[model samples]
Target: MPEGSLYRMAAADINAAVVFEKVSKSFGSHVVLNEVSLLIPKGAIMVMLGPSGTGKSVLLRCLVGLIKPDSGRILVFNEDLTRLDDQRSADRHKLFALRRRFGMLFQDGALFDDMSVGDNVAFPMRQHTKMSEPEIRARVAENLERVGLPGTERKMVSELSGGMRKRAAFARAIALRPDIVLCDEPSSGLDPVMSATLDDLILELHRTLGMTFIVISHDTAEARAIATHIGLLYQGKLQVFGEAHTVLQSSHAHVRQFFERNTQGPIKVL
Candidate 1:
């Protein structure tokens, strides 16, 4: 059997919420992901760690069908995303439906400055669902409360503190009750206490909702706090991947260098 066929067979686990089979991508001559295959179990909080420009965010974008891989397959709930081209009218609905399963919190909050907090959280529902204004309002209030920002609905986005903005963004991300939440550097630009607080919010949401979470971060502390599964990508390859504790204990030079913050290891500054 061909090597690609073997990867497809291995990626066909029914228990997996997402799978990447021999996926690769390149921008011009710059290779971002090189045959990276991974299986993310249903409801697992998988934290992807890597140095800057190692394709951590690229992998996440591929999972959501925003960027198609150059080769291989990406499966979400057993449906292959690479086969569906969103730019093609025939595949748009299928692609949109597949994307609805995911909620993405961008590196920056990405909230609209002109919108009120309530309106921001209501945006997705208004765009995606047929819920009435009253119903959307109720759901908006509930999501804000879940993110510990209850009753701040009327405030402008400018009125929120940095941490509050992130929390508000979290509320919007979960507003539609997506099955998978993708957090891109949730703790970036925050004080340690605020970062910890965000981490706690993640834990609380995962515990209560039982949704799958894939977090992209440079923070080992965040991974230690919330990752059930962990993966480290370097130089366009996955260096280590397994349960959080197992990967933490890995003897891989790249993994150790990252977690230990050693400057003299295999990972060179770029």
Candidate 2:
């Protein structure tokens, strides 16, 4: 809470986990996002759904500063990230500190193939904390076990199956015990049974850790199973945003058509 700062501020009592205000982004001739705004409450799982190239992933990247928006503001816990100018020494430090609070699980898991499964999980703890090797090892084991991959520290990452790899990535994402976790397409490229299993793991983690989760996903069933809130993005704009049941049961033909994977809907086929 700075004295009289222009940083976008949420109410002290609102307890919003993340807020985006009139955010817009474009790449050359293509507009990826247009005045997108949404609120993610703490301890809630918000599933963002859209077709490919609809800018759901871009929206996540913007929050973590991977891609800067062309305009507008993004706030985490009332701290305006968009206002944190990296050219200033103090602001740069603040930006780094703010980012360290986020844990991200990439779409493909993005584990280092050369690193052992245990070492991969320990990577964040090693870089971010002064924890001893023994402590790091213990945390790695604990996280692996929690993801239902118990005692997998000695195994090579290349040896694990696709589902195992995703779960391992989830383990690494939580290694820092972050305030919020960002997951991009958690169920992508997995069989239906494995996807269901992964969805169960997501629900379990949310229940136990109570961390705010914003997940970008195409799987309607997975989103319905795990989301406390659901948002739909279409053509550089948000079409709908609401609680899971309300959004899922939407009378909007596009919403209903999307969930049903219908070819005849408002969403244009590329």
Candidate 3:
């Protein structure tokens, strides 16, 4: 059976892929996230959108334990990552185990310039698994093909087009067949056509992989195209969150200003 099919089979047993209860994070005196609460269902495509520096990426990073919150609870795969202390042997073990359940696609592809595309895709597996080299190679090829990058395994990261680089990073992200995928600014620098294409690829992955997706982005079009759920963050707080249609219909001034892309609202043009 396919990995997605397996996830679908297990979906009914899982309550939520991720849950946040009054989560907050701060850097010294500057708050980045404030009492944000959310529940992300399994297999749902949830987009976290906001202006730059509004803590969109911070939310995703928190989900994967890359950023620890100062207070409140965040549950990813039932593990309280915020509570895990790497100082303890057992907690450190638990942290790594929980993190493995998630795959992340960072901005700018973040591919190793020296590694071949195939090797980049294979890197995660090599780091985390004991699979034979041939098996690892086969899985790398399959994931690359899934991202529509077939036959480019030997190509260097420098040799790829911008859009292709994005796809290649995606291939690397899914190499571990994680239960959830987190994307940071997946549409950052692409043209409309390529951005839409990337959106389609994301949709395909969610549909076929049966994994929950949390994307940090600012593109309204991409969110409208791909999100089943939407969360709007501003000034380090989640101003609104709900089903796509509900979020779109929100009457909040901040929400209105954001959707309208206007310079006249709460988001000051500095």
Candidate order by decreasing TM-score: 1, 2, 3
Q: Candidate 1 or 3, higher lDDT?
A: 1
Q: List the residue pairs that clash in candidate 1.
A: none
Give lDDT: candidate 3, residue 47: 94
How does residue 173 of candidate 3 score in lDDT?
90
Per-residue C-alpha lDDT of model 1 across residues 11-52, encoded as one tens digit per residue: 677778888888999999999999888888889999999999
Question: Per-residue lDDT tens digits of candidate 3, residues 16-60?
Answer: 788777788999999998888777788889999888888887888
Q: Could you give candidate 2's per-residue lDDT for residues 1-270 as a string of tens digits?
A: 121122244423267888887789999989999888777888889999999999999999999988899998888888888988898999999988888889999988999999999999999999989999999999999999999999999899999999999999999999999989999999999999999988888888888988889999998998888999999999998888878988888897768988988999899999
Q: Which candidate is the best by TM-score?
A: 1
Q: Pick the candidate with the highest lDDT.
A: 1
Query: What's the TM-score of every candidate structure?
Result: 0.96, 0.95, 0.93
Better of 1 and 2 by lDDT: 1
Error of 2 at 88 (Å): 2.0
Better model by TM-score, 2 or 3? 2
Q: Candidate 3, clashing residue pairs?
A: none
Taking all chains together, the TM-score of candidate 3 against the true structure is 0.93
